[model samples]
Target: MKFRKATKKDVQAIVEMIADDALGKTRENFQTPLPKAYYNAFENINNDNNQELIIVENENAEIIGTLQLSFIQYLTYKGGIRAQIEAVRIKRDKRGTGLGTKMFEWAIKRAKERSAHVLQLTTDKKRPEAIVFYEKLGFVASHEGMKMHFS
Candidate 1:
C-alpha cells in the first residue's frame, strides 16, 4: 500500500469512497463529482498549514482509503496543538484486512511529528465496532461531544 496527500486528480476516487460510506451507514454526505461548493474544502486543505487529507492506494494504483487530519491551535495551550482525525473510510472489500489500523497509525505518527499535544477523533455512538477499534488504538472517551445538524 502507498500513502500520499490528495490532489485534484484523486477527487473522483475520494468522492466515491466518501459516497460509499454514506450509503453504508456513514454520515458524511459526499457525492461523486461532488458539488462545486465542495471544492472549497479541497482547495483550502492545500493552503491550510493545519490541515491534511491523505489517500491510500493499492499496488494497482487504485485509491482504497482516505482520512483527514486537522490541527487546532489555541492561545491557552501555548505551544500545544490538537490534531483531529476525521472522515476515515476504507473501501468495502478492503474492510477487515487491517487497512484501517495502518491508516490510523499513519495519522498518529504524522500528528506526533508536528508536536501535537493530543490526537483525537469522533465516531458516531451508533457504531459499536468502530468504538471498539478506536479503543484498541488507545483512544479513550475523556469528554462528551455534541453536534447540532443543520437540516
Candidate 2:
C-alpha cells in the first residue's frame, strides 16, 4: 500500500469512491466527464500549500482510497495549526478490511510531520459507524458541531 498526493487524473476515482455511499448519493454529482466544479475545487486545493488531497494505492497501483487534509491556521489555541481531515472514502470492495484504520494512522503521522498542533475531523451524525470507528481510534466527541449549508 502506498499513500501519495493525488493528481488530476485521480479525481474520477476519488469521486467514484466518495459518491459510492448512502449520504454521498444525495450530495455528490458523480458522472462520466464530471462537472467542472470538481476540477475547479481540485485546482484550488492543489494550489493551496495548506491543503493536501491524498490517494492510496495498492501494490498494483490501483487507487482504492482518498481523503483531503486541510491545515487551518487560527488564533484560537494561541496561534496553532489544526490539520482537518475530510472526505475520506475507501472503495466499496475495500471497506471493513482494516485499511481505514491504517489510512487514518498515516494521516495522523502526516499531521505530525506538518507540525500541526492538533488533528480534527467532522463526520455526519448520520454515520454512526464512522463515529464509532473514530472513537475507537482515540477521538473524543468533545464539542457539538453545527453547520449551515447554502443552496
Candidate 3:
C-alpha cells in the first residue's frame, strides 16, 4: 500500500468509503449528483498549508483508505502546536488488516515532523471497538468531549 496526499480525483472514493460505515450512512450522502459541499470542503483543506487530506491506495492504484490531519497553532500548552486527526475511514474490506494502525503511525510521524507538541482526535462514543483500537495505539480517554450541531 502507498500513502499520499489526496487529490480532487480521490474525493469521490473517499466519500464512498466514508458513507459505507453505519453512522456515516445517516450523515453522509454519496450518491448521484453527489454533494457540492464535499468538494467545497476538499478545496478548503487542499488550499490550507496547516491541513492535509491523505489517501491510501493499493498496488492496483485503488483507493483503500483516507484521513485528514490538521496542525493548529495555539497560545496554550506553552505556545505549542497541536495536530488534530479526523475523518479517518478505511474501506470495509480493509479493516482488521493493520491498515488503520499504519495510518496512525504515518500521522504521528508527520505530526512530529511538523513540530506538533500534541496529537489528538475524537471518535464517536458509539464505536466501542474504535475506542479500544485507539487505546491500543496509546491514546487515552483523558477528557470529555462535547459538541453541538447547528443543523
Which pairs of residues have clashing backbones in candidate 1?
none
lDDT of 1 by residue, 1-151 (tens): 9989999778767767776754443555566557775577789887888889899999998889999999998866786899999989898899999999999999999999999989999988877899999999999999999999996
Per-residue lDDT of 20-94 in model 2, one digit per residue for the tens?
A: 999998899999999999999999999999999999999999998999999999898888899999999999999
Error of 1 at 76 (Å): 3.1
Residue 54 miss distance in model 3 (angstroms): 0.2
Best by TM-score: 2
96 in model 3: Cα distance from truth in Å?
1.0
Which regions of candidate 2 are displaced past 4 Å?
none
Best by lDDT: 2
Q: Which RMSD values do the candidates have, in order? A: 2.0, 0.7, 0.8
lDDT tens readout by residue for model 3, 1-151: 8999999888889999989978999999999667999999999999999999999998999899999999999899888999999999999998999999999999999999999988999999899999999999999898899999997
Q: Which ten residues in a row have the lowest lDDT in candidate 1?
A: 21-30
**Superior by lDDT: candidate 2 or candidate 3:** 2
Using TM-score as the yardstick, the better of models 2 and 3 is 2
Instruction: Kindly indicate the candidate among 1 and 2 with the higher lDDT.
Output: 2
